[model samples]
Target: MGRGGPREIVQLTGDRDAISSVTFLADGKTLASGGGGMVWLWDVSYLVKPLSFLCAQVGRSFTQEEWERYVPEGPAYRKIC
Candidate 1:
């Protein structure tokens, strides 16, 4: 998208083999990918506000030291909640 050919907004990992197909369901919030004789369904609605969703699930933001250790070049830490 945009000037680039395509962009990656999020990554869904843990597949054991190469993904052969992908499709969005009629609801548009669900994504399906198939490979390795299996099909996986993903709830993609959270992509709209992934940070908020993650913060809710994790229940806490990274500490300043943790942020600095993980994202040395990132901007100053801010509470995601």
Candidate 2:
């Protein structure tokens, strides 16, 4: 997420072409970015993994349990503990 400053915690770069529109789906985990010739739907729920920053730097993918543990909910984000 991008804060008030120039610093951005998450940098989502998928569209190779110029982006025209960006919108978040009702679930808030799905992001739709449109531009150029095609539209891209990104599932941001994957970012909820614990040690996300470290994992990203090492090019690692988190298992479902990891995301659930860190997100306080579960992989589905229902969050009932």
lDDT of each: 0.76, 0.63
lDDT tens digits, residue span 1-71, model 1: 45445666678885647679999998888999998788899989886676577578779987778768754
lDDT of 2 by residue, 1-81 (tens): 333445434678775567889898888778888887788888787555545544665475545666565544323543232
Candidate with maximal lDDT? 1
Worst 10-residue lDDT window, candidate 1 = 1-10
Candidate 1: the clashing residue pairs are none
Q: Which stretches of candidate 1 lie over 4 Å from their true place?
A: 1-5, 49-81
Q: How far is candidate 1 from the true structure (C-alpha RMSD, Å)?
A: 5.0
The residue pairs in collision within model 2 are 73-79
Candidate 2 Cα errors over 4 Å, as ranges: 1-6, 47-81
